[model samples]
Target: MFIRGGNMRILFVFIASILMALGGLPQQTESAKILATLSMPGRSQYIFVENYLKALAARGHQVTVINPFKNNKATPNMRFIEATKVQEYAQEMLTEMDGSNMWQEFNGYTRLMEKINSCTLDDEAVQQLLKSGETFDVVLAEMIEAPPLYGLAQHFNATLVGFSSYGTDFRIDRIMGNISPVSYNPMIIAPRTDRMSFSERLTNHYEYLLEQVHRELVHLPAMERQYKKYFPRAQKTMDEVLDSFALVLLGQHFSVSYPRPYMPNMIEVGGLHIAHKPQPLPEDIKEFIEGAQHGVIYFSMGSNVKSKDLPQETRDTLLRTFGKLKQRVLWKFEDDQLPGKPANVLIKKWYPQPDILAHSNVKIFITHGGLLSTIESLYFGKPVLGLPVLYDQHNVERARRIGFGLGLDLHQLKQEELEAAIHKLLSEPSYAKASSQISERYRDQPQPSLERAIWWTEYIIRHQGAPHLRAASRDLNYIQLHSLDTLFVLVGVPLLIVGLLLKLSCRLLRGSKPKSCPFADKQKKQ
Candidate 1:
């Protein structure tokens, strides 16, 4: 009672420390052993998971990643199991995937996923890792096309954490027991804004149904084959693996993407792949960008889509259009030579995309509408003119909906149209204003996406899978999830009661009346 103020403060600190150590207060979990796999094809997909795993490793976790895309640079606390064979199959299948044809694209991806899984299991490095008798705290895997990788979690008796490079779709929504209303939540295959017209909602609902049928009839069967082939002795079945995800981190945000519902276990960590600040550009590129008398226009088709693959006519149109522009153009062309390259244009095999977008001289981005590219453009506050091809529709549609960009049909593109679109983006102040507003909202988070992703990941490990965050709806069947059975009772019971009342009234009338009506009987007697 007579202790000095300093002594009392020390005593309070001592008590708090004891409480924390004794588990009365929260404390950091010990380092974890993480087994992660990324079987998705694109470099963009790999970037999201790679950055996340790096963060986990930096936080004292030991990570082993099995991916086709290998980081040559060696780093401590992380090991790479390069499954290079996955790439061969992925590329071949990607070429066959026609984004315009729904069934064709679905079948193509289904076959591709099967081959990718088989190749992953067949890889010597992966085989050795699996047989190494290694145990892990968690297995982080891409949720989209790599369900077979879930077996690794079962093998190691670890929780499975799903990592998606895009927002949740119908398949993911169903698995996670999240509500994705068709009226507003657009299907991945059918792109639309949240505010849809009547026709758009109808189409969205139809597409959603078709997606569900495809998942059951086509996608699930393909996944089941891969699961059984690799993990025949797995403790849980394929259905169980689909349902047991501890949590999923989605690289989507409402700032650019449409607002949608998510479960407690579904975390939005959009833009985690984007650097907090752009990295330095190479000397040549920096000079080209800075030396632009007018602002520079940056064009890229992302990693999977090569600019060199464009038809000769389209290429000519682009060159001819760029030739007329006052601005300098920087294009990410895969080929070494551009036959008709414009004097105002610079072609490189690759450019540091985010760094290029970050430059003050950059005016607008002409992109293929890949999710990562869309996010990067918004992050840098640059208006876009998107030439969405294949799976690029959704991202481009979002850009158009947000008023920061415009989309052109790649198939129907003409020189006049291309020039007009580019000029519109540059001349319209509203486009730049919208881009800046969205960029501010996108960056206005309490913490960075990378940090949020890492903390949630660690939280799962600390809380032993965090089962409490999981939705109860995961246990419900389709009929139950939608309350269809409840609806049947609600409607059928009222109808049944009315039918019974009608029957009773008929019976009462029949019993109270004579064989003939009273008046008719009287008339007959008279």
Candidate 2:
């Protein structure tokens, strides 16, 4: 009886193995073609692009990436396409102009548009892409501003997917819909009372108008001229063509952002940065983190800002503040030397930010409030002390006010204030609690962000550009797109029509009763 039972178990194992083999458990085909463009190199943007491409290749797809790097450096299973030489004219124009504040942003935009307009459609990058031996099923463009690649995607008649490095701001949606490309950060969670504030509303209104003017008066004309020059054979207007078929994959998670209405194609795919397995910290950094006694505070201004650019007085104030703090400080300063070294402070040009945040000894992150930094702190369940410098940093820091984090203006930094903010964060535990709650929400998402991005990219290819997801802006006219004017016209028109009719009716009644028509007089006599 025991032998018979053993024989039955063996049979069950054999059958299960056979079933697994027959099911074709790989679950994906090996030869599907995908083309991805990474317009920037050696930046966080490239990192996100590389990961997504790797994910696709792992899923049995043939992936080719177009990287702008000229040094022939790239990962396995990826190809690099050298971008065209930037025009000297554009460069000189940008240099001669003083770009300060919002005007600087516009100057950058103009230069970019000029470059796009000047680029030849048959440039080496575009030719190599078209002539590449493999037939691509789909093309994904990294940013809204990558004109040559966006043009190439059109030329190849492949499905176009837009990957935004920022969150799903309404302005990006407008660009995809051919409405207007305004700048906004959807990651900021504005409180109801704050949104209603007169100052806030006024700022919003001014931004909206400024965006519209920039798009209609400044950007669109240049885009149209470029479209005509590069894609003359194309039938549709630049506006219509851009809006025809596209999807926006934002690098943000819904959990951390404010609740707002989003279209189906505008997907939230944050935490793609954290999707990969964490790398082990180097021995020196590991030892420093392990040896901390009163906990550690991580400070970084992110990649774009140079710590050396900070004024000497500001740097001295920061160093002094760190000296007073009981916690050990890790400052990501580019320079090795400080005027006075704090006993507990360690200065490194760069730090393995994620690994350090994961450490138990780390207590708070002092940041420039860049979106990625803020999100990373939230991902690791650590609170932030934001020092906003430029661009959307203001929006990011303000948004964090919804939670337990604190924001400090970079322009208002004083030794006492910095010390006070740092001390408060160390003593209070609620900030960490709030951050962890957000982290839990992020973890509870249905699937990892990279997986969602890959699935959507492939799904669009499978369904022939996913036309069903495209938004229809044809129903929207000039007045409708700008609706405040439409409301005034709708109300004003009815009142005018009623007044005109009343006057006409009164004139007819008076004419019939007394003087004007002979027929009216004859009828009255009868």
Candidate 3:
């Protein structure tokens, strides 16, 4: 009986290894087809492109990437369309986030869009591809940054797939018919908690309305101009072109983000970035982490926010706060030298972030609350202390309220406040416990997220855009969607009855009014 059980276990392991090698999707039978992609909003977004595009290529799809980053090296089945020397927009955006002037932030943001448009329009690679006779089975683009790139799909007569770096924004929500209720659900970019007070709800509603108005009044017009500038020959309107997207691959799922009512055309492929096994940490880092008597704390502001760029006071406060802690600290500081360094803390310019979080001795993460880092901390069951800089980061507050972590304001940062927040996280057992439980649920899927992503991608190709998955709301206008047309009729019909009754009663009170009426007059004549 023992031998049989051992054999069974070995067989199970063998089959799992085979699946892992094939990237965990079903065995491919279809011949390779062309799948072009454009997702160069930032370095981190490009990281996602490197992940799934390679997997798609491995599954026998020919992949062509139009990105600013050079990470996706060409192969027999893969190619690159280099957008000439585009700066990483995330760094500039972070700078704007730290600024006081709202207009400055807005201008910085507008500048980013212009750069993206200019890069594609002027790039020798993109220009050649746009004018070439090449075709692709599909064209995937980043929904947030590059809506104009949808023209690539239309130009090639290929299916359109939108790749969302994080959760759905208001525009994507309206398209997919998955807009969450602001009464209970927070806005996509707003950092409000789920359970809101009356004032909070009112604020959320106002923000949602403002976002819609801005897109209609400001953003969409600019996008339409770009769309026309790029693909002048295409006949479809901008809204029509957007709705034509066959599927949207979003960074959301049950454990990492709040529940959303998604339509069939929307696919949640959260944690696809971290689906693979992490490489081992450097020997020095391994030794430092393993040698700590107490657990270690990992600090990173993600890829874009250099620790050196932080104000001197902010850096000094963090150093002092970490110095006071017994636990060892490892910071993803981009500089080789941080003067007045603490003995308890270590610094590195870059890190295998996921691998470090996987270590048992790592206690918590102090992060910028960037979506990828936020998901990884939760994915690995490590408690977090979020110092959010910008964009969808306010959702970090939800993590604190749910007992997985705590948050602090970066602009208001001080040594004592930083010290206290760390202390609270370390002392609280509930945070760690909650994180662990959630991690278990997050990994408890039937198939890996990468496999799921690959399957859906292939599914769309096989079915020629998967048209049945589109939601009815895609065809609905605001009045029809809200049933305002029905409401007006309901209200108007009742008012009409009441109005006629009032007129008839007034005629009766005036005496002999029925005889003067047209029907009464006709009956009298007969």
List, residue by residue over 1-526, the lDDT tens digit for candidate 1.
Answer: 5999999999999999997879865457799999988776667888776678888888799998888886789978999888887676655777767656677678877887788788888899888887888899999988875678888888889999998887788778777888787888887755588889999999888877776778789988889988998887888988888888998999899888867778988889988888888788999999988999899999998888788988888899999999999999999999899997989999999888888999999999999898888899999999999998777897788788879999998878899999899999999999999999999999999999998888899899989999999888999987998899999999999999997776566557666554444444666799
Model 3: per-residue Cα lDDT over 216-243, one tens digit each = 7666778788888887888676777787
Where model 1 places Cα greater than 4 Å from the true spot, the runs are 1-26, 99-101, 512-526
Candidate 2 stretches with Cα past 4 Å from truth are 1-30, 40-42, 68-74, 82-104, 112-135, 146-148, 176-196, 227-237, 335-343, 474-526
Winning candidate number (lDDT): 1
Q: What is the C-alpha RMSD of each candidate to the true structure, in Å?
A: 4.3, 6.4, 7.1
Error of 2 at 359 (Å): 1.8
Pairwise TM-score winner, candidates 1 and 3: 1
Q: Which residue pairs does candidate 2 place in steric collision? A: 252-270
Model 3 TM-score, 2 decimals: 0.87
- Across residues 192-270, which tens digit of lDDT does each residue of candidate 2 receive? 2223456666665565666557767776677677767777776455665556546768887767765555667777887
List lDDT for all candidates, in order.
0.86, 0.68, 0.78
Which portions of model 3 show Cα errors greater than 4 Å?
Answer: 1-41, 72-76, 88-108, 512-526
lDDT score at residue 495, model 3, on the 0-100 scale = 96
Candidate 2 CA-lDDT value: 0.68
